[model samples]
Target: MAYQVTLQPSGHQFSVQPGQTVLEAALHAGYALPYGCRNGACGACKGKVLSGRVDYGATQEGALSAAEREQGYALFCSARPLTDLVLEVHEVTAVQEIPVKTLPCRVERLERLCHDVMGIWLKLPSSERLQFLPGQYIDFLLKDGRRRSLSLANAPEEDALLELHMRYVPGGFFSEHVFNVMKVKDILRIRGPLGSFYLRESDKPAVFVAGGTGFAPIKAILTHAFNQGLKRELVLYWGARAVRDLYMPQLPERWAREHANFRFVPVIQSPLPEESWSGRTGHVHEAVLADYSDLSGVQAYVCGAPAMVAAARRDFVARGLPADEFYSDSFEFQGGPGT
Candidate 1:
């Protein structure tokens, strides 16, 4: 049996089929809901059920605490509708209309940006170019049925070759294969561009915080903004462990030099003496907080480790950043229930 689900405020409705999660139904109906690690780990798709019943499927307890459940919040990615339901959740309209596709691509180049970060450029078929927002990601379909997710580092306007930045996790199978075995002309299948994190249309100034390889999507967003001739002020704070971790530092520096509306700040967490690093120190989000005492008038986009993303969201919203104005995608190595 299928049940109808209605979104509060917008009143957008879709049908949830038997065994299908609310998220699956929403996606099938072309309604974009905020989600990450669709596996119920990230808590990005949490929403309140205003009516009817749902089978709250498997979810990490930390992600959806019993207290949160008592408060009427459900993880849409893992919640299966038992009856007609009304839910309260913000919809992402930017990518709702964009078609997601599974396509074959060939590895065109692999440029190692640092000891642990590799820049992957995939060449798609000549007849088709992907249509995606700046901050969306693509999942590489692997032979063993395992999928590797990587954010598109290049903006949509620069779609000749899809760019991705991948961090080398020492014992990770796919990552190790990419660094050691993957080659030019290697054929790969990918489904993209997924995720709700993107550069939204806003008149407010933008603040971007990126940690480690999380700079990929932010780079795309900023580049697209510049290409579109946006006059809004944009400041990026990139956090890294050391100078070596600051891959492509010159690119953001160049951007700052060329664009009067853009500014780049590099924050090194643990700078080594021999690296000759001198910059803002500590967490990327904290750096932003230090600069802007009141973030009431800005749109903040952050991508990084789970801790950083969570801390930033909590602190930023607490410091006057409208809870709705903050956009984020927390990097989960083992992404949960990815769409």
Candidate 2:
């Protein structure tokens, strides 16, 4: 049996199968709902259930608190509606059209962006072409049927190489192999182009908030913007613990110098005394809020740690930034063998 699901405000309607989650049904019906970490670890898929009972399957307690559940909030990615439902969710129209694909790729190169961050490039088979949006991600299929997710750091261009920024997690099976054992020419299976985070084509000014290596997708989006000759004002706020963590600092600086509409702000949460640091300091999102008090006309792309992404979404929306205009991808590492 299928249950009718209606979205509030927009009044868009879709049908959900008995076993499918709200998000799956919405996506299947061509409605792109805001989401990240579809596994229910991140709260990015949270939405208000207006008038239906839903069974939230295996959701982490921290992802949605008891108080939130009592208030009719549910994670669309994990919630299965029991009856016809009315929901309130922010839909992203721009990214709704990106297609998804699964393909095999060979490792072409591995460049160390930092001590712990590696820029892994994969070359698609000559017979295949990977069609994906700039800020989407692909999941690496493991031998045991498990998967590890990583965002693309390069835009879809004529070049058939897909770039990924992988952060090394000590004791992680995949990270250890990637840093110590993985080599060029290795064939890896991937299923992807998932997630709703992407550049929304708009004339409004853009604020890009990146934490740690979350800069990967943002980099792809920025490059795409530059290639397309987007004239909208852009400010990139990249945050890291130290100067060394801000990998590819030169790229943003060079981009800002070349594009009159672009500005780069590298923020450090902690700086060594000998580093002679002089720039924005403290939290990266706070820096944006301090500089641009009125976000009523700005669009923000936030990608990074779950904490940072969640905080920015709440604070920025409260400060007049339209909730629909704020797109984000929260990187959540499942502490497993191949995470």
Candidate 3:
């Protein structure tokens, strides 16, 4: 059985399947409802149930006080619709809506994703949560008064373990430390949710071109898009030197297999004989250029070396992609993100 769930003011409606919580249905229907600790510990998802009834699935007593529940408020994260319902909630509109935070995080896990890419997972203090747009980044503050910017690779919804992709740069201080000395439980200070490279709400199709670890930000963006069950079509072209260079290839491949609206194109620059490579070869942007002659109708997000970004932007616009629709963030091996 299913019931219709409608948002107040906007009157946007979506169906709540029998097993789905209100929050789950809302997100699946492309609605961004504010939430924290979907486990019902936080009241961030609390909203007024203007009409109809809910089961008020499991939740902590203090999270949804008895008096608050009596007043027609329910924690949407733990609420299940008993009938058609109306809720009052606001969508996150801009960066101002989310606080830029400076918090200490523990190195929860360190995973070597490839020869050059290492995945870092940071765990925030139990009492603190960093609210950030999916593609935003954080600057790790070093004791030497320097900062290294690392993009959050995980989506906002799965933020319990904030994810970062670090490429092993031989002479880079931060990358060298992360690959060598960083250990689990190492306390790190950081300030962020910075950068403007977030997904803009658009119904237009999206084309993403990622180079090396530049896929970090795009991974966050696309994961959020998928979690929201967005209807827009998305095509991603990730470029690398060889098959081994394309770390985490299974992820986008799985996304392509699972989502009808998603497509993944792995572009290998050059493959050696033993590689047995038969996939798309050459520059990542060139693959996009080959597939899309008229990108004016779609949005293009490119992340790579400065030269690649510049070339992709110039050629994309020349191929009819709107100047405004082309967004890019270039990687700085010596500096950091957005530098």
Candidate 4:
């Protein structure tokens, strides 16, 4: 039998299926309860059980002490509801509510997504969790006193391993290292949960335009939205130089197939004759303009090079999108060893 769990303060309620941990059920029910590690090892999911019995399945004493257990504390990641219960825990609602941290992470895995794009996964220390808002980015603190920033590609709900997509920049320091020398189990220092480009609370439909590897943060935002069961309509225009440049197009395609309110359109700027492609061809923003004659009712998020972002901002605003409804993150690759 499933047990109903109620959250204090917010008064939100969800069901905990048999054999499921509180954190797992809460996440499945679209609640963003704070958690790290998702195991008994980390106390990030520790919270008070206001009024019920729970089977503290495998909770480590180091995470939840005997005294704390006597005080009604339990690690939701390992706790199973014994009956209907009430839980008191703060939900992550905004960027400011999250703490920025400098943590050491090991390169857990690496895969080349395409000719120029590489997928990197960083595993944080088992005792730590980097709680962050979707769409925020992190900076790599290099040994040479240089920093490289990359948008996180995974949603907060799936925090076991952080994901990043890096585009190889020729002769660039970080890009060269990643493409040529970086290896699994290599330790690196990073600081973040930085940036203000996260999705804002609103009733308006959202339109996203991504260029090249700018798809990284947008992927996080979209995954978070889908996991939260957001009902708002979402459309994405992912642009690339050629079909091959779209490293992870299959993901959005799958989302489009699974989500009723989601749509994806891939735009190829200039496909060579040998490419054999039949789809929207041109700049990404132009595709949006052609489809939606009036953008006054929707929110627009554009991420790409400075030139693309600027042009999209200028043209989108002129087309009726409210100035405040438009958000963007513009980036450029440093010619010298930086990303």
Candidate 5:
């Protein structure tokens, strides 16, 4: 049996199958709902159940607290409606209606950006051109039926190649292979353009918040914005633990120098004595809030560790930024035997 789901405010309606989650049904019906880390790890999919009961699958306690559930909140990624339901969800507006594809790509080149970060370039099949928004990500199809996700580090252009920024995670399955056995010309299967974290075109000034390798998608979006001749003032706050973590430092510096409306601020959590670091210090998001006391008219695109994204969203919204204006993608590492 299929259950009917209605969205509040917009009044859009859709039908979901017995076993499908609300997000799956919404996506299948072309409803652009806000979401990230579809595995229920990020709270981006949380929405209020206006009128119907839902069975929330096993979700991390940290993702949704008891207080949130009591307030009628549920994670659309894992919630199965028991009957006709109405929900309060903010839909994403910049999502394009495009068919996703899974294809094979050849690793064209791999360059070490830092001691632990690698820049990987993948060439698509000549016959197929993968169309994806700058902030979207692709998942690697592993032999054991498992998947690993990585964000594209370059904007979509005429080129038939995709760039990815991968960080070496100690003991991570994919990272182990990438750092140890992966080679250029390797054939890998991937599916993508997934996630709704793309930049929304607006006249308001923009603030980009990035942490570690989370800067990958942000970089792509900035490049896309520049290529499209967007003139809105853009400030990028890139946070890292040390100087080495800002692997592609030169790229941002170059962008700031070349793009009249762009600015770059690199923040370091801890600077080594030999690093001679002299820049912004402390958490990246904190630096943003410190500079821009009021975010009422600004749009923020944040990507990074789950903790950083969560903190930025909470603080930014509390400080007057519209909730709808905050777009984010949290990179989660799959834990277990076969990551």
Candidate 6:
């Protein structure tokens, strides 16, 4: 059986399938309901039931008090609709609504995603949670009074461990340390939920272009879009110097296979001599240009080298894409070791 659920204020409606928690249904329906630790440990998803009954399922001992439940409040993360329901809850629709936090985190795990890219996972204190837009980044506060900014590679909903993709820069400060010295259990200070490069709500098709480690934030954005069950046509053009540079290609390949609305195009600028390759070649944006002559109706999210971003902006706008609909974030390697 299924229950119809309506959200107050926004009037957004979705159906809650049996055994699905209200929070799960809302997110699967593209609604951004505020939540933390979906396991019912946090009360961040608590809201008024408005007009119907729910079976509060496994709410932690202190998360939903008896008085709170009696007053018609339920933790959406742990509540299941017993009848058609109307819920009054605040939705996270803008970046400003989330707070920027500076917290201490331990390097929980690390993996070499590619020859030059080191994947780092940071675990925050048990009581701390960082809510961020999918494509935002964080600044790692280094001991030498320097800060290194890296886009978060994981979505807010999957916040158990924050993910960062760091590309090694020869003799560069942070990247070298990340590759050579950083280890699990190392304490690092970070401040963020920063940057404004996030997905905008639109019915237009989306074109994502990523270069090098710039794939980090784009991966997060795409995952969030998928989780929301977005119906818009989505495509990605990931550009790399060689096949080896395209780290984690299988994940996007999986997405292309699973999401009918999605398409993935990998463009390699140069392939190794021994590597027999057949795929799109040249600039990543050029692949988009070849497929799309008119971008007037689509939204483009691009991240990568400054030169590529500039070229895409110029060419895409010339192709009729609205300037405002083009969103981008670019990174450059500094001489001394910064991203």
**Top candidate by TM-score:** 5
Compose the digit string of candidate 6's lDDT tens values, residues 208-250: 9998888999999999999999999999999999999999999
Q: All candidates' TM-scores?
A: 0.92, 0.90, 0.71, 0.72, 0.93, 0.72
* Ranked candidates (lDDT, high to low): 1, 5, 2, 6, 4, 3
The TM-score between candidate 1 and the true structure equals 0.92
Q: Residue-wise lDDT of candidate 3 within 54-140, one digit each (tens)?
A: 999987664566888999989897999999998877654476466667899899999999988899999999998888988778889
Q: Which 10 consecutive residues of model 5 have the lowest summed lDDT?
A: 330-339
Q: Is candidate 3 or candidate 4 better by lDDT?
A: 4
Clashing pairs in 1: 37-336, 38-337, 39-336, 39-337
Q: Write the per-residue lDDT of candidate 4 for residues 115-201, one digit (tens) a residue.
A: 999999999999999898788788899998998888898998898999999998988889989999999999999998765567888
RMSD of 3: 16.5
Model 4: CA > 4 A from native: 1-93, 334-337
Give candidate 3 regions above 4 Å deviation: 1-93, 334-339
lDDT by residue (tens digit), candidate 5, 132-167: 888988899999888888898888883567999888
Q: How many residue-pair clashes does candidate 6 contain? A: 2
lDDT of 2 by residue, 79-109 (tens): 9999899999888776666666778899999
Model 5 spans with C-alpha error above 4 angstroms: 59-67, 93-96, 333-339
Off by over 4 Å in 6: 1-93, 334-337
